[model samples]
Target: MLASILMTVRKRRQPIIRLALSTMVAALLLGALACSPPEPVRIGFLGGLSGRVADLGIGGRNGAMLAVEMRNRQGGINGRPIELIAEDDRQDVEVAKQAAGRLLAQKPEVVIGPMTSAMALAILPQFNTAGVPLISPTVTTNALTGLDDQFFRVVAPTAAHVSKSAEYHFRENGLRRPVLVCDLRNKAYSESWAGDFRTAFERLGGEIIAEVGFESGQSLAALASSVLAEQPDGVVIIANSVDTALLVQQLRMRAADLRIATSEWAATERLLELGGRAVEGLVVAQYVDRGSTSPAYLAFLRAYRERFAHEPGFPGLTGFDATNVALDALAARSRGQTLKQALLTQASFAGAQSPIRFDAGGDTRRDTFLSVIRDGKFESLQ
Candidate 1:
């Protein structure tokens, strides 16, 4: 009976010993974790990787990649590496929403795109609810101006920048009368661009002789004929590169010598390829001056060309600028500050083209340039 009582006592003591040992292990693990370096910061990049406007999305993604890779090569932010999580929204609203849901689950502190204004609008509300900061590289919808949300952009608003283009056409280009052409499919961008340009040009004593609309995959011959009938001094084509190419080709067939200009919306490689000789001598407004020789821009350009075998254009340049802005915010976060507050309070960022500054409404202000297509390449006239 004494032996049995000793056995019970030992069993109870064994439980107590195990508890003590487990507590010690837990404490040791916590100490080691505290002593180790922090994990890499997560950044999400969402853009269209497939579908019609994939070139712009690809360019933006490439730019973001360059920024992240360069930062990593230079020791990253405060010794913590950065891991970029890229997603393709396919430029569809529902797809963008789904992609955003998945990305938010990854808990990225910041996100880099939704390159088009439409995609940005689609996913911004969800990101706002999650309190994640989203900086777009090329979203320029007029409706997004002054929006009280976490959405910020590197490109200027459509109304503001397009108005400047109007002034350029009237004052510098010496075009008194012009016809406006818009793509109805991308009404959000094309309509706003045409409307803003019309309002500004008319205010500057220029006349809009005609307004024409067309849809992609439809014959633009009738629309082109109607526009040429007006015999305007110049034609303003506000559409994506493919649609712009079709319209310009049709117009060129009628009057080869007619002056033509394009909104920044259609400024892409696809334009040069599809429009061919028709796009030659076309004046276009651009957010980035590709001819900039600034050291910072030159470094970026060289790296970009080396990696992609192509020159960086507006989408790439703006994407690089936007990602750098996010990196700055991340750096601030590592120092016990909030990302949103840091972005709002930080000073201007000198970018590839000009100094970029954000207003209280998160709109970006920068200089624009007028470029002419010479030999199927953009040559900055500014």
Candidate 2:
């Protein structure tokens, strides 16, 4: 009778033990789910991450990604982590449109950029319709940052900037009349810049003594001769910096005494590489100092060299500084809200660059800096 009772007790306890084991397993699963982090704050970087301007896009994304990583390390925004989504626009307009659409579908907090002017123009209308803010690292066309408040570009609008700088260079050098040598028949940068410069110069008591245009992949020595025959006080040449160097070399071959009063884009290492000492007497307007050699710049150069196996290029540094500022804004923004409001509330933003306080229209009315090439290098002309 006692043996029968023991068997019965063991059978009942076996069921209880199984039930307890199942409850423990369920509890463990629930605990793990609780420990998992909240949904990540999504940010997308849209740029020409492939093709010709890939260097610029890659550098910009690096700075932005670094900012996101740093923020995540210190417990993210409102305790939610950050994630960056990047795509290559290939520096093509149609591709930029498709990439922009793809990124917007991900429902990111903010979209970083579509770098070039063409790309920016392609994405602008879509971003405007979606009410999504596109913080551009580089689109510097004057018509872009127009009456619309949504067009926020970190790069100085080249057309307006060149206008003022051209006026200054002309007046300071006492160049009354000038010849407008343009690469309009070919390069996009040349046509727009030449148009803006001609208008600005004419408004500032300067006459266009002669006008000349060239086709892409083709250079003419005769145009330089045409410009010289007019005997203008100085020559205002507008072309893509790389092509500009080729034209300058050809122009210098024709006339040893050519003095230029021109725009900012001409100040790249590309010009010096092609034209060499011929570019020494050349004056240019610059927003960034190539010869900065400051602590921040030096540190950036070192880091860039480490990652890229080379020094930073012109647009690379600009894109780096610009994207980093936006990322800093993201990290410092208020929690529990979309990034747009936080960016709008930022009264003042600072980075390795100058203090960037966006106006209502998101354009900077900043003064232009001048630089003169000396010894095959750039020096700020204060």
Candidate 3:
């Protein structure tokens, strides 16, 4: 009887051991599957995040994020979630090159932004070599206009707007003698803008009193004093918002009745906040018409305000447009077509600011507007 009882006990324990072993094997398989990598469609974003030009970079990054979020919410590209790898170049050329390399390492299908023309030029070789399409949102230099590379921009070259501005000031405003002050730090855009404006103004029977340049980390007060000494009828300031505001403040302090105009680069809201009353009545060229009532523009404005808790400026608008271009290309790719071919074939992209139609040189023709700062807001002068 004792032997029979022991045999029953051993048989019951044998089944329990088998059951525990089976549970352990199943858990292991589940864990392995959980640790597996996810497949995602990647897009690389590079811009200056920490530097004097951080505003532009931050705006661009936010815009790109908005695009990514909107696409993901709408089921993403062919059900594969889109990923954005953002890198800060700190507004340095070498840093931009390294950042481009790091972004390219992930093998992203497309890249968006370097914010400035200099950074775009620095990182162009990397994207071109890797055969990745790069869409620059705010690079306005004419240097890359006809380059047969993968680089493209949402904004038109500086030549067009600056020339128009020159005509507006000389022929319309009757500002015959103007002084040109440019920041060498962003020579890629500023220099081009100043040069184009000078050419156009001179051609339109206006005189450039003096052309002065200020480098980064230099004293703006002295530059402003020197420019004031020229007693120009109107002044054309070609610098970013920060420097532009400083120069404007200095100029206004010295001469209360001074007339000032600026390039599109310095036409952000930050300029009004920084320059205060000094920027009032200041003429500036802008790529976006703030008075647009289009459905696309209004929708973008609403979404941007909700996400970022503020208004979107040129940088934000252009960034959003550039990313949309990239997303459209990605969508085409999902249907077994390539983004490059679509872009080169003159893809029609409806942007928040305007309808985009790429030309043979991969540049878009945008309508720039003249605006003046009135009561700390941009009022269209056109």
Candidate 2 worst ten-residue window by lDDT? 183-192
Q: Give the whole-model CA lDDT for all candidates, comma-separated.
A: 0.86, 0.69, 0.86
Clashing pairs in 3: none
Kindly report which residue stretches of model 2 are placed more than 4 angstroms away from their true locations once superposed. 1-26, 31-40, 49-83, 146-149, 158-160, 181-196, 210-233, 290-302, 335-337
lDDT of 2 by residue, 22-116 (tens): 99999999998899879998888887666435555775677566556656788877788888899898866678889989998998877777666
Q: Provide TM-scores for the models.
A: 0.88, 0.77, 0.89
Q: List, residue by residue over 35-74, the lDDT tens digit for candidate 3.
A: 7755788998988888678778888888999999999999
Model 3 — which ten-residue stretch has the worst lDDT? Answer: 332-341
TM-score of 3: 0.89
As a TM-score, model 1 comes out at: 0.88
Per-prediction backbone clash count:
0, 0, 0
The parts of candidate 3 lying over 4 Å away from their true place are 1-38, 334-338
Rank order (by TM-score, best first): 3, 1, 2
